[model samples]
Target: MSRTPDNWLLKVTGLTKIYGEPNENTLALTGPQFGSNICPETESIVACADINFELYPGEVLGIVGESGSGKSTVVKMLYFDIEKTYGEALLKPYANAGVNTLDESNQKKRYIRNHLMGMVYQNPRDGLNFNFTSGGNIAEKLIMAGNYHVGGIRERASELLVKTEVPVLRMDDRPSNFSGGMQQRVQISKAIANNPPLLFLDEVTTGLDVSVQAKVLDLIRELQHELGIAMIVVSHDLSVIRMLTDRTMVMKNGRIVESGLTDQILQDPQHAYSQLLVSSLL
Candidate 1:
């Protein structure tokens, strides 16, 4: 998809996440060049640094890297699951894209998360309430976004379940009773319950069986096409990235080493790290 400044749904600049106290040279000392995110000077961990990107509406952007490559950290910071040490992210639908979402107050951040964004984690437990029925989990998301009509909530929940290929008969069962794949489907349904423009998926199919993974990925593709929801998909699996994303960002040791059209990256990766990844995928 063609992306212009005015057409971007989300703009992120200089996004950095570091753990522990760090001095001025922390970021400089850690990255792909050093082959480590750990700063020798201050012992701080740079989960990600100087990340910049623009996600257009209805576009699927992929962050592909191996474990510890900081792909997940980027999305976690944007989703407010973790704090950013430095950076700014602006969502066009919020504050006319003038305010940095990372700087927003907690209450306002929650409001943005509830209404403008959604997340589906690799582990369903992190995203779903096992104690609640599958339908109830979706209900919680809807209710938080100000949906109070019980009948409407149920109707929407069932609709989402069916849309995601989850049997409506299982709606009343708790996540604990569902298979891993089923749990993920429920997680996805809840994530999109509010029809958020932006969604984040972090290694969502990592542990599923191969057949199950394909099903989940297919469902996700269907949802994206049907809802026109833009997504930031973080995955170590190149296949997952290849299957879902429009554009791709290759991360390694806390920095984006390469980024461009997914097909271009796959066919002719410029960065050595990215080349290694694409070659492995082939």
Candidate 2:
């Protein structure tokens, strides 16, 4: 893909993360035993290694992989929830401010999360505050972003609830009070509360039934098109990716094994892993 100087919304290069490195004493119940036969004595479990990808403005990049493929790890690193062991991540601003670099020391990632990036996790319960009402959750995000006016905050919350097709009447109810689908909608509302330039959706529809998943995917596509925001959708559901994303990247063992236009990848997969993934979807 040709990356324009101005069009790149996110850039990731040589990104890697290693956990439970040698010298630590973390133990496992049952696993292969190496030198010390201790979890911490083994070398790092490379969750992601030398990962490279770029997201352009208004594009949806689907990352498809099985369990332990590092999909969640990648998203977490992008959100700065976990510190990366190595590599660089840059976010291009929507206002032509140029690419801002993120790393362990610079802390630029935090700034991006606060103002430019948003995330929706696979489990809505994980993302939403159970104690807060749906409107309160959305309003909390706005307030955290520095908008303090009560009337304006409530108005925006109501508008977003409507945008996400969540009833305004349910706005005052806690997320725990809603059904799974409704809770997911509330999570989407909270994610877009700030109108972020980039969104990371980590299996947002994973546990929902097929019908509910379809509805949620449609809502995401509608929102993405309407807002012109860039998105990275990490999912194992090939059908969902095919329906929602512009392009797809197939990952295995912490590396991108194959990537191409969604249709092309589905029709003519280049890598063995991609072929297997595509075949399983069929």
- 1-282: candidate 2 lDDT, tens digit per residue: 355865677888888776766333433321222212224446557676677988888899999988887778988988877888877787767235344354334454555676788899999877889999999999888887889999999999999999999999988999998878889999999999999988999999888988988889899999998998889999988998999888998877666778889999999999887888889998
lDDT per residue for candidate 1 within 1-282, as digits (tens), equals: 566658999999999989999999998899999999999998999999999999999999999998999999999999999889999999999999999999999999999999999999999999999999999999999999999999999999999999988999989999999899999999999999999999999999999999999999999999999899999999999999999999999999999999999999999999999989988877
Give stretches of model 1 more than 4 Å off.
none
Clashing pairs in 1: none
TM-score of each: 0.98, 0.88
Over all chains combined, what TM-score does candidate 1 have?
A: 0.98
How much lDDT does each candidate structure score?
0.95, 0.81
Question: For residue 198, what is the lDDT in candidate 2?
Answer: 87
- Name every residue pair that clashes in candidate 2: none
Alpha carbon deviation, residue 3, candidate 1 (Å): 3.0
Clashing residue pairs in all predictions, respectively, total 0, 0
